[model samples]
Structure formats: C-alpha cells, structure tokens
Target: MAQGAALGCLTIASLVVARWGGPAVLGEYALLRVLPWLTGVIASAGLPVASTFFLAARTGSDPRLRPTLLTLALAGSAVGLLAWAVAVPLLHRLFFPDLSPGLLLLAGLTVATQLFTVWGKACCQGQADMLGANIVIVGEELLFLPAYWLVSHAGLHGITAVVVAMVGGGAAATALSVGRLAATGFFTGRAAPSLRLAREVVVFGARAQLGNLLWLVNLRLDFLILDALAGPAVLGIYAVASKFAELMRLPATAANYVLYPRFARAERVDTDAEVRRLLPRALALTALATPVLALAATIALPLLYGQAFRGAVLPACVLLVGLAVEGASAVASAYLWGIGRPGANSFAMGLGVVVTVALDLVLIPHHGAMGAAASSSAAYLATSAVLVGLTYRFSSTGRVSTVVASRAEPL
Candidate 1:
C-alpha cells in the first residue's frame, strides 16, 4: 500500500513537472537522467540483489554482514563516481549538448546519492523490513515533488530546476535511508564481516551485476536511441508517453517488493509452491489493470500535458501493452534471481535487448515515436515469453516431484 501510494505520488509529480515546463523541459530532464541512472545501476554492481539474497539467507546467523555489505557498496559508489566523470563528457556531447558544467556536476551528485539510496534499500530488503524498504523506494520522489514545485513556483524553470530538485531529493532520501538503517541497529555491534563471506558476496555480486546491467540497458537504451535518431522534441513526447506506460508497472513493482524476500526464503526450503501460487494472481491483476490504465491515460494525458502531448496517447497505449507483459515477467525474473539463476535471467534480457536494438534501428528513423513504441513492446513480449518458459521449466520438475511424493505417501 505504501509503495503504491508513493509510486502514484511520483507519477503525479512527474505530470506536474510536465505541465509546468512542457515538452522541451521534460525531454531534457528525461535525457539528463539517462547517464546518472545507468551509471548508478552499473555502480551498484548488482549488490542490491546480492545483498537481498545473501543477507536474507544469513541475517539470522550473521548480523555483521550488514555493515560489510554496506562497506562494499560504498566502495562501489566511489568507483561509480569515477565512471561518471569519464562518461559524462561523451554523454553530454551526444545527448545533452546544452547542459552546463555545473549541471553536469549536479548530475554526478545524483548518481552518488542514488548509489547510497540503492545500498540502503537493499539492506532493508535483505532484512525483510518491507516498510523501511518502501520508504527508501518512495522517499526521493516525495522530496522531489515538493522541491520541484517550489523551484518552479519561484521562477526557476527548465533543466536547471529539475536537476537541482533531483539532486536535493536524492540527497534527502539517501540520508533518510541511512538513518533508518542505523536506527534499526544495522550498523551496530562489534562482530565484523568475515573474509570468506566478503568473497562470497563479491562473487555473487559480480554475476548479479551483469544481469542487472543488462536489464537496465533493456529498459533505458531506448531513450538514447530515440534521442539520436529523432532529436529532443520527439524524444520528449515519447518520454512522457513512456512515463504513463510505466504506471502500468506499479502493481508488479509492489508485488515484487514483497515477493522477492518470500522467494528468497522459499529457495532456502527448496519449495516454489508459494511463488507458483502467487504469480498467476499477480499477473492476472496486472493484465486486467493495463487496459483500464490505458483508458485513464488516454483521457488524462491530454488534460495533464495539454494538446502538445496528444501524440503521446497512442504510444502510451502501445507501451502499456509491453508494461503489462513485463509485469508478469518481472515476477518470473525475481524468482529466477532468488533461486540463484541470474545467468538465465541475464540471457533472457540479452535476447530482448537484441530484439529491441534490431527493431529500433530499423523502425525509429522511419516511424519515429510509434516505431520506438513498437520495438519496445515487441522486445518485452519476446523477453516475457522467454522468462516465463525458463521459470516454469526450472520450477516444474521440483513441483512434479513434490506432488508425486505426496501422492505416494500413505494416507
């Protein structure tokens, strides 16, 4: 519930920004986000998933692992900062030529703060503190909306205000997350993390990181592709449409927050019955919600964004189809990761990225925003099919064995 409300607020906040600043500003904000978000995902090195899996498994026996995981994440953030420095100039020249050095520096800060936020949320998730985890997830947008509104009202418009608001919100959220962890005694006690455990985490994190990086690429690479081929104006329109499409994902996001921990614990017991039971209902709900959301968005988008964004309607609807497929796929992917099959998950995402890139290259130049939408939706459908098949194959044999054992037992 908290996660849903927070995500809803985020959607509203984004709409507010769009209404206040229009397409160019919204497009620039979306473009500026690409590098930092991508860099932060890379910098985290899959520690979020690694931490959740390892920590959930070990939290009962090794409380000290929290600080160790955090220490490793902090080191990863420093490395991520260095990466941002190298990537920023190239990214700026290619996508954000008008951005000033100061704005770029602020973008770097966003990446650093986001790393901290990711680490903190990972810790809460590892501990199975759902409330704390949701807070961390939602905190930034809560802060960002108010800051954005204040700045815009105070006559600061365009990318400058958006970047400042982003940085401020990120800093605030990171602090709150860290504070929540400290308050819960995550950083307390004298027992230190072991070298063996550290090595295990690093090894797991490396594998998980690759999968995560690929997954992010599948999600965000479209922005860059669109910007290069269609320019900012078209990209901005598509970005707005994409945001509405993303709302279709809220149910899946909420489900995964609770499901990942449950899946992790279930993996320990070698039982997937719980996951199997819950997945269909989650997917059904998401499937049912998508068209309703599409209807609402069709009506609301024009009102919220004005007629300048009327073109976003069809694209948003198309992307919602993909998001709906992605909702179910997300649950399956989480199950795969929880069961320590990130390699398989990565392969699925890689296949999807290939599909997306192939289609985007052919389609974006000719069809523009609609082509981008079609490419993303097709890729999502293909990837979802692969993941669903992989997940069922992996879990079905165990399920059959369990069923046979139960049937054969004396009753």
Candidate 2:
C-alpha cells in the first residue's frame, strides 16, 4: 500500500507533464527515460537480484558481504557513468535525434544515482527487513513531488525540469537507501573486495539479467515502434494508457521486491511449494484489481490527465488482459531467478519479445495504440504461460531438489 501510494506520487509528475506539455511532449519525455533506465539496469550487473540472493542466503554468516557488495556497487556506478558518457552521443544521434542532446546528457546522473539507490534497497531486503525496504521505497518516491515543486519554482520546466527532478528524486533515494543500509552497520566491519566474489556476482547478474533486460525492453519497445510509425502525440496517449494498465502490476512489484530474496534463501529446501503458495494469491490480486482500476480510470483519466487523455481508456482496458497475466509471470520469474534457473525466464522472455516485435510490426501501422495494447497482451500471456508451465514441470518432476547448493556459489 505504501509502495502503491508512493508510485501515485511519481505519477503526479507524469500528470504535470501531460497537462502542461500534452501528449507529444509527454511522449518525447518518455523516450528520454528508456536509455537511462536501460543503462541503469545494465550498470547494476544484476546486483539488486544478486544482492538479495547472497544477502538473504547468508544473512548473519558474512559481515563482509554487505560492505563488499557496497564497494562493487560504487565501482559499477562509476563504470556506468563512463559507459553512458561514451554511448549518449551515439544513442542521441540514432534514437533521440528529434530531442536535445543536452537533456539526454543531463539525465545520465540518474544512471549512477538509481543504481546505488536500488542496490541499497535490495541489500536491506536481503535481511528480510521489509520495514526498512518499504521505508526506502516509499521515502524515495514520495520526495518526487516536493523536488519537482522546488525545481519548477526555480525556473526549470518541461522535460528539462522533469529530468532534473528525476535526478533530485534519485539523489534523495540514494541518501535514504544508503543511510538505511548504514544503520545496519554495513561499513563498521573490516571488508575487502574479493575478485572471486565479484566474478560470481557478475556471472549471476548476467544470467539473471537476461530475462530482466528482455522484460524491460518488452515493456518499452512498443513505445519506440509506435513513435516511429505514428507520432509523439499518439505515443503520449499510449503512454498514459500504459501507466494505468501497469497499476495492476503492483502485485507483481510486491512479489519481485519482497518475495524474490525469500525464494533465494529457501531454494535449498523447496521453491515449488513457494511458487504454488504465492502464484494463486498474486494472480487473484490482479484479477480482482484490474476491473476495479479500469472502472476507476474510466471516470478518472479525463479529470486527472485531462480530456485529451480520454482516448487512453480503451487501450488501458485492452492492456489489463496481458497485465493480469504478467502478474503470474512476475512470480514465476522470481522463482526461476531465486532458484538459479534464470535461463528458463530468459527463454520465455525471448519468446515474448519475438511475439511483441511481430505483432507491433503488423498491428501498430493499422491500429496504432490499440495494436500496441493487443501485442503487449499477447506477448505477456505468452511469457506467463511458459513460466507457469515450467514451474508446474518442476513441481511434478522434483527437478528442484537436484539443484545442489554449493558453499561458494550458492546461486
């Protein structure tokens, strides 16, 4: 609930953008986000997932683990910033030629800030510290409005202001996350950076990120295609619809943020039962929430995002089908990653991407936003089916027991 409300605050920034800039400007702003967000994920080297895994599995055994992970996160952020410096020029030329290079370059700050922020939160969750994790999550997003308010008053507006506000929010989150992590005395003990541990983290992170990267792109690829074939105005309407549709995914976010580490910690005994136990609850939450949220949005979309955004309602309704399915998929993915079978998720997400591209190619030209919605729904269901099928297979075959946990590479 706190997380959901915090996201609501973040959405207020979008509302401001939509109201002031309309759909075209809004669409452009969304485009600005794709690169930094993608880069941030790349920069993490999957540390958030890996942190939760290693931290939870060895909760009290290793004091050095927290500090070691912290050191690596700092180093990774530096590398990410350097990489962003190199790539932003080319990326701006290719993908965002219509937008300003200066704005894109400025948004690079988010890559480093967001990486450290997420790593800290993931580290907190590693110890089953839900209160601390939730505090960090809520604290970060809740500050978005105040930061935007301050920056807007200081003569920053439009996408530039939003970008700056995002950096501010990220910085705030970094302070909160790192501060909370420190409260646990992460830096008080003697620690050294272990290359062996670093290699293991990178490898695990790479494997875990395969599906994650695919999933992230799957969420955003349609926006690019829609923008190309249609216009920014059309993409903006679609973006509003996408945001509303994703509200149903709060359950998935909860599972990913909280349950993933638990799965990692308990994988030695049984992941199948956890899957069976949580899958139904998460799926049911989506089923119940989608229609209610859709109904609410029908009345609220125009009032909140303005009448220009009324067109988003139909598309949002269409997207609910796939999002409901994605709820199940998220839990299944957590199970796969937690149990070190991330290849299963990679295979599923890869298949979903193919479906997404093929459908976007065929549908967007004809149907526009509705086409994107349909494509997203079909692709989501495709990924969900595969994940659920794999979990069931493992359940029946006792394959999970074969995954012998090693002391060094626990998974």
Candidate 3:
C-alpha cells in the first residue's frame, strides 16, 4: 500500500509538471530523465537483483559478502560515470541540442546519486524490508515534487531547472536511503571484501545485469526513437499518455516487489509449484482490472491534461492492453529470477526488444505515438507468451515429479 501510494503521488506529481510546464517542457523533462535513468540501471550491474537473491538466501551474513557487493557496486558506478562523461557531448548534440553543457554535467550527478540510492534500496529489499525499500523508492519522487516547485517558483524554468531539481532530490534520497540502511544495521557485519566473492557476484550480476539492461532498453528505447523521429511536442504527449497506461501496472509492480523475495525463498523448496499457483491469480486480477483502468484513463486523462493531450487517449488505451499482458510477464519474470534463471529472463526481454525496435522502426515514422504503442503492446504480448510457456513447462514437470515421487513412496 505504501508503494502504491508512492506511485500514485508520482503520477500526480507528473501531471502537475505537465500542467505547469506544458507539453514542450514536459517533453524536455522526459528526455533529460532518460539518460540518468539508463546510466543508473547500467551502473547497478544487476547487483541489486543479485543482492535480493543473495540476501534473501542469508548470504549477507557471510563476512566477505557485504564488502564484496559494496566494492562491485562502487566499481559499477565508476564505470557508469565514465561512460556518461564520454556520452554526454554526443547526447547533447543528438537529443537536447539547446541545453547547456553545465546542465548536462549536473544531470550526471543525479545519475551518480541515483545509483547509490538504488544500491541502498536493494540492500533493504534483500533483507525483506519492503517498507524500507519502498521508502527509498518513493522518497526520491516525493522530494522531487517539492524541489521542483521550489526551483520553478524561483523563476527558473525549462530543462535546466528540471535537471537541477532532480539532482537535489536524488542527493537527498540517496543520503536518506544510506542512512536508513545503516540504521537498519545492514552494514554492521564484520565483512571484508574478498576476491572470490567479488568474482562470484560479478558472474551472477553479469547475467542479471544483462537481463535488466535489456529490459530497461525495451522500456525506454521507444522514448529515444520517438524523440528522434517526432519532436518534443509529440514525444511529450506520448510520454504523458504512456504514463497513464503505466499506472495499470502498479499492482503488478508492487506484487513483484514482495513476490521477488517470496519467490526467492520458495526456490529452496519448489519454485515451480509456487509460480504455478501465484502467477495465474496475479494475471487474472490484472486482466480483470485493466479494462476498468483503461476506461477511467480515457475519461480522466483528457479532463486532467486538457484537450491538448487528447491525442494521448488512443495510445494510452493501447498501452493499457499491453501493460495487462506485461503484468503476467512480470510475475513470471520474478519467478524466473527468484529461481536463479537470469539468463532466461534476459532472453525473453531481448526478444521483446527486438520486436519493439523492429516495429518502432517500421511504424513510428508514419504512425507516431500510435505506432509506438502498437510496437510496445506487441512486444509485451510476445514476451509474456514466451515466459508463460516456460513457466508452465517447468511447473507441469514439477507437479508430475511430485505426484510420481508421492506414489513411489511406501504407504
């Protein structure tokens, strides 16, 4: 519920930004956020998810585990920072042609802070502290609302002000999250970094990171494509529309938050049975709720965003359908990850990315937001189909084995 409320606040804050700044400004803000987010994801090196697996499995108690994870996290951040430094100039030229280099540099700081914040939250999540984990997740956005208001009210406007506010909020959230982790005694262990542990973490994190990276790409690449093919105004409208569609997935998102750890623990027993039992219920609930959400969005979005955003309606509806499909996929993905099948998750998302990119390339130039919507929906459906099949196969085999084992045992 806390996570859900936080997501709601975020949606409201985004609406406030759109209303205050207008579409072009909103478009620029959306564009600016992409790089920092992508950078943070890359820098995480999939360790966040790996942390959840390891910590849930109680590996954090290992004297060497925590320090090794910390070292790897720092190393990943350094690599991301270096990559950002090299990419900024080209990115500025390509995306934000009018923004100053100083502002872009500030955005880099936001990325750095975000990486640390994600690491902190992952630590909390691994301990099965959802409240603490969510506080970190939501705190940044909560702080951003106030920070954005202050910055905008100070007579600063446009991308510069937006980026500055983001940096401030990110810094505060990172600090708070670190403090929270420390307070929880997450760092109290007598751990020292070890080469062997680090290598294991890297190997595990690499597979997870690759899957996470591909997933991020699948989610965010459309923004880049849209911005390149269409202008800020169009991208802005689509961004808002898509955000509305994204709300439909909040239940799934929250479910996965709790489910990942649960599934991770269940893996020690029989994950296939757990997946079979949990996934269908999640999918059914999501499937039932999505049309209602779509209806509400269709009526409410135009009213909230004004007719200037009416263009977003169809795409939003399209995306709602897609997100419904994604809800099922998310549950399956969590099960896969919980069972230590990062490679399979990565393969599924990679296929989705391929579909998304191909469709976006073929359709966005002519159809714009609608084309992007179609591509995303199709990709999600395809990914969900593949994952569902895999989960079913595994779960069915597990069920059969359990029955056979039961029958063979002396009565």
Please give, for residues 245-354, the per-residue lDDT of candidate 3 as tens digits: 88777888877777777776663347676777888788887788888988888798889989999999999888877778766787888877776667778888889889
How close to the true structure is residue 213 of candidate 1, measured as C-alpha lDDT?
Answer: 73
Model 2 clashing residue pairs (backbone): none
Q: Over 4 Å off in model 3, which ranges?
A: 398-411
State model 3's lDDT.
0.78
Off-target runs (Cα >4 Å) in candidate 2 are: 267-270, 407-411
Residue 33 miss distance in model 3 (angstroms): 2.6
Error of 1 at 235 (Å): 1.5
- Quick one: best lDDT, which candidate? 2
For candidate 2, which ten residues in a row score worst on lDDT? 401-410
lDDT of 2 by residue, 1-411 (tens): 767977787588678778866788788777765666567768768777778777776433666676668777888888888888888778676556655777777788888887887788887888788888888888777776788788889998777777788788888989999888788776677766667777777777777778888887678889988988887899999999998888887778887776677777774456677688878887887887878887977998888888889899999999898887666787888887777777778888999899998998999999999999999988988888998888767655445546654522634
Q: Tens digits of per-residue lDDT for model 1 on 315-392?
A: 999988887876678788787767666777888888888998899889988999999988898888888889888877
Better of 1 and 2 by TM-score: 2
- Give the TM-scores of the predictions, in the order they appear: 0.92, 0.93, 0.93
| Local distance difference test, each candidate | 0.76, 0.79, 0.78
Which pairs clash in model 1?
Answer: none
